[model samples]
Target chain A: MGDLLRRCLMKRTDPDAPQKRRRGAAVALWGVMALLVLWALFNLRAIGDAFVQFHAFLAYRFIRRALIVGMLVSLCASLLGVTLVLKRYSMIGDGLSHVGFGALTVAMALGFVTSEGLPAFLPQGLRGAVARLCAGIAANPLPFTLVIVVVCAFLLLRISEHSRMRGDSAIALISTSALAVGVIVTSMTSGMNVDVYNYMFGSILAMSTSDVYVSVTLSAVVLVLFALFYPRIFAVTFDEMFARATGVRAGGYNMLIALLTAMTVVVGMRMMGTLLISSLIIFPALSSMRLFSSFRAVTISSAIISVACFALGMLLSCVYSLPTGAGIVAINLVVFIAFSAIDATR
Target chain B: MALIAIQDVTIAFEGTVAVDRVSFEVARGDYLVIVGENGSGKSTLMRAMLGLVKPRSGRIVYGDGLEKNRIGYLPQQTAAQRDFPASVEEVVLSGCVNRMGTRFFYNRADREKALGNMKLLDVERLRKKSYRTLSGGQQQRALLARALCATDAMLLLDEPVTGLDPNAAAEFYEVIRSLNRDHGVTVVMVSHDLSGAMRDAGKVLVMNRGMDFFGSLEDYRTRFAEGMVKGHG
Candidate 1:
């Protein structure tokens, strides 16, 4: 029995023993990759048929636009998600999206009035420019919504940090108020009920070409800013007070996070809806955190997971005639659960 | 020459005073141990020295070439902070942020300094480990490594041994004593263990919402002998 126990301990401690297990893991990984390639090849014809059907459909242009917007939104939201989730500000995304909803409703109401006609007191050129701007805002409310939501997000952050109200309570108060105002404004505005419904429960098929352009431009801005300030953001997320003590200007980094989140929330609201958009920011980060320990690793994994899940969700929705927002959220939920299970087993 | 001077500093929250009319001075190479019960503003006074809070009145002035960024601070950690998702190396490397001024990335010098500090703290082998997985003693050692990387001039620790076992705490105290004695690093430590702290501290500041006593260890022991017995009783 002593000899057997010694042998068992030697086997466990031998470094070369894990080499065999690693080889097995490598083989399994390659096998999975090969199977995925084969499956893609086998489904090529069906995918082609789906594409043809999509193109022949009346809303092909809208579908293309929605796809572009969805990809951009998913990328930015997931990138911002890692820091926000770690900093315990995950719910800020939800609050800001509701604020965007309220702003969208107000913009819609203003657009309706502008289309009816500007007052004659305005000069000719100024009238034309104002009319064009109002018309643009009416067509794509994201820019206007972005401004309102960013301002409100900053306010909420300040209130939470400096006021007697706690963080969660502040977020709840702001989000619920914005939601109530949005519902009231939507009811008050006549003839835009369908438009409001589309915003509430996103209609990807209703996205315009300009929406795609705006989303791409804003996503590029967010990506560039995030890359430039990655180090500062990491410091702030880990310990804001410590970061401040080290002269890193933690508050400035926090403002940048709020700004990025606002932009992501606005862009995402078109496809994920105001109510469901925060899931795009929350799910991927949480899932990646289960598997990766470092900030950089978790961030990269989150981005990949978010893009993959969004693509899968879009494809499933297109093939099965499902609600786009709900489909994406459901896929994210599954991925989160799978990740949690894997982490538990490990 | 004094390294830092706190002149009649008063810190308050809302309408309540936390530290009132606190005056103290830390001379060069002094090991000052601040002892107080909970809610006695020991941590608040330290924070004031670090410039974390604006004093309601008076001022904290630094001399002897010490600057705000050059002071290493080991703040009291909460559970959530202890569980921050970062590797030991990453946490230690962040101490270089002040020196890296306007630079986005840490350079080779910063990396060498971080590694050296890790070696000094005997945490070099755990460089790649996740900070959250470390035991209490190891985590404090890692944080000490980070603080050392920040500056060699001085260290200000707030309850650095709160959760450490007796042996771990004793080891930590030895490490701190060597840093002060051998390396000549000024230390301002806030601690609850007066008996243990009295062994190494050059001066002691006993506080209870105000300055109960501020003098050398021998003078403090002699001045507060009856009070200490009554308090313990």
Candidate 2:
């Protein structure tokens, strides 16, 4: 066992490999990037027409929104993913998505915004004013879901830090519990409805205009915060204790990471679905890590890959009439495999 | 005044005490090596001085124009860092984060400072390489250069040579010795190597959950080293 472990660990460092493979990796990277740019250049008119003709046969209106929101969400996810995945907090995205699902289901069931699940079990006295007061929020369940997921993110951080429970277990506990509640609420109120199915599997058509607005605004906030605190985030992620000793406010940066991740997960869950949203957070970062050595290289490439994957996935889904979420995930997997192959050859 | 003065500082986690009523002082240009067996609170005391841990009762005073945040620290490596995807330059440059002070990105000055330190540690050639790809000695040099970027006046190293081979450990010690003797940096190192660590230190602090001996290295060698070895061996 010890020999096996040592052998596995010894493979991590090969002094000659990096120096020899640098040129090849760079060539492959630029070749792919140039190909993508050329494709975009050639398809510029079709892309522009999609915007002008929203009701076109492909339902370009929904595709346009999904592409915009998907690109932003994935950009934010991949950027944050590099840090979180390094810190082993990648599953926080999965946990938060499950929590978002639970919050959405409960809100719908309580008659917050949906008429279909109108608090049938509520007492007569409490139902009228509660319904009226929450009616405004019902129109957009995003704010409610955002608030809940953000709070849960903070709680998960706290639990992982202070409690004796390990991080993975804490995540598993919260995620499973939330998912169960969502399923129970669904069964209790409206049974297995199309809305519930859409939330689970993610349909590009499920995103409303207001959801797009929220996504754009939140994604902008995420991007700005990430840019401003990039160095501190790197410091904190690399070595928390060292950063703390050097007065980097490690706790504050940790909370910031959690907060940004929560926002991304909530916004992304609308299009990617609770079940598959974490792929947006995990796949790009992992794929980029295979080929890039520097943090900057990995991060920039991850963002570009995420946005490109999302765009290509949307195109495939539009042409083949495939499920948008599955198509994106499949594309991400293919990219990951390709990158791994590149790494192996090098 | 002393660079740092620990007055009866006791550190505890939860209910159990890790360090009990430990007192010591490190003056400017002092090379203080703290030695102890495993779980003897040497590291806890060092952490308390770094302000990573708060004392249960006593005070840790920093004087001699030493800001709490400006002290360079070379901490033990964590598992996460083993596979961290960052260039050597990026890893070293992050040490300038505390000094950046509201600046979002590293400026030209920060880059120059990082490069100068890398040159000092003889790691400038490896700047563009991946950090994880370096050998153990090279990694240590990179981390030491990172520490130098934070401050030239003082350093706090916690078991910096723990996993290094004998040659790498000796080379690291020589680098630190030069930093102290030639550059006049105050160093507080918590190490397990007694005789080897004592060769370069001006002061020796023996810790067993508290201060067992705190004095000049000559006194520790002449009066306390034999008894300590006998007691702990």
Candidate 3:
């Protein structure tokens, strides 16, 4: 029950603990990660031969991308989530995902080719037709990506700022708006029928090489940045006024985090879609909460959770003919429920 | 030389003045203790000194030529910070973050200093422990250790000894006294314990809405709060 959680969630810094225990916990979490990959690998036969053959070469490379991207995203999210959760802004992840959706919609309308391949949703003819429509919107994809992100970011900032509204509320409200706009815009455009559903649920099997490239690159950048600013972010998270008084530039750092979140949201949308992006960010964190104590531990554990969940999710969706996006979230929900029950027991 | 000088500082929230026209001066290592009832602008005055809020009027001048990272601060237990995931050691190490001016690993010397400071505060044994696991008094010590890492100059404690038992509170007060007398770290503590803290304080500032009374400890003992004609309720 809570015992397992207590062991992992609040255990980060015990000045008195032996280093051996910490290392042991780290290894066990990694072991869990390895087992999950092996499980997924054993069952990857369901991934429809054509797509897997053309894009997903040997088992190692395909698994590596999923594992690497999932872990990296989870690690970054966990590092930021503790602060966000403690600061009571945990809902921002959800809101940002909707903004990502709106960006995707605008990206679609404007026709930008980021080399991330075409959308995997809809019939092949429809994919080309939508591409043509997007092409008609603008010749360049980058500016399309840029404009939607900026607009959504601006709107989100206003909502969170003006009312001093609770962050979760802001996230829920904005995401609903962005998501509704996504539905309305896609519907009005015609011929893009499958687009919203695909985004809503996600298709990990359809994850393009370019999608992995974009997400992983963004993840790497976030990792490096967080590493460098660890102390500053740490101070701000613990005691903002103290951080500010000690010359940590808490305000600047908070703003930077908001910007990073925006980017993470935008890039991550390609995989999880707007509706489920926050799950990718949140579930791994919630799952890892049962096993790690320190901030570093939580970060590491979350990465493990993300990798395991994603690999399992892909296999489960293919076998059950389930929606990939919903399947991932459902698996995480089940895991969370199971853990909460055990936690209550403790 | 006076370390703190304030003139006509007024702070308000949504049209109600928390501190009104407060003015006071404190000499170096003077150990000026502020006494007030709850919501009596004591905390607001302290926040004003820390620049958390801008005052509506007047100015606050520091004779010590304040450095950005020079002041040590201990805030009351804020809900905003109760669940931060830092280890006690890492929490203390944040004191060195600003001082690290250039980027890279925190030089070994800085880390050593932080460890020593934590040791001084007696929370060294909890250094590897999570900041949130420690009890109230221990948490305050951990915070003090963090503050000590920031500067060797002035120390500001806002109701730091509140949740402690009498003995622990006395010990906490003694540490403040030692910091002032031995380390020459100037102390400005906001407290409701007027009688107890008057022992070591060189000066006392009674703040109602603002600085209602300011005098030497001897003067305060002679005539408590002199006159409370203008005070905030």
lDDT of each: 0.83, 0.86, 0.70
Calculate DockQ per candidate and list them.
0.52, 0.80, 0.55
Residue-wise C-alpha lDDT for candidate 2, range A1-346, written one tens digit per residue: 9988877889878647876687676677667756766887999987676544433534557677877888888899999999989988888989999999999888777663443345688766566666665665555678888999999999999988889999899999999999999999999887899989888878888777777887798789888988888888898988888789889988888898899889988888877889999999999999999999999999999999999999877776676667788889999987986787577667
Evaluated at residue A251, the lDDT of candidate 2 is 83
Angstrom error at residue B129, model 1: 1.2
Q: Residues A263-329, candidate 3: write the lDDT tens digits.
A: 6665555556667767777776666555444666666666666666766665555556567667677
TM-score of 2: 0.88
- Per-model TM-score, in order, reads 0.86, 0.88, 0.78
- Candidate 2 lDDT tens digits, B1-233: 99999998989999889999988889999999998888899888888888989899999998999988888999989988988899999989999998898789999999999999999999999999999889888998998888888886899998888889999999999999999999999999999876678789999888888878888988887775466555532
Worst 10 residues of 1 chain A by lDDT: A24-33
Chain A (alone) TM-scores for all candidate structures:
0.78, 0.80, 0.67
**What C-alpha RMSD does candidate 2 show over the true interface residues after superposing them?**
0.7
Per-residue error at A77 for model 2, in Å?
0.8
lDDT of 3 at B156: 83
CA displacement after TM-score superposition, residue B109 of candidate 1 (Å): 0.6
Docking class of 3: medium
The whole-model C-alpha lDDT of candidate 2 against the native structure comes to 0.86
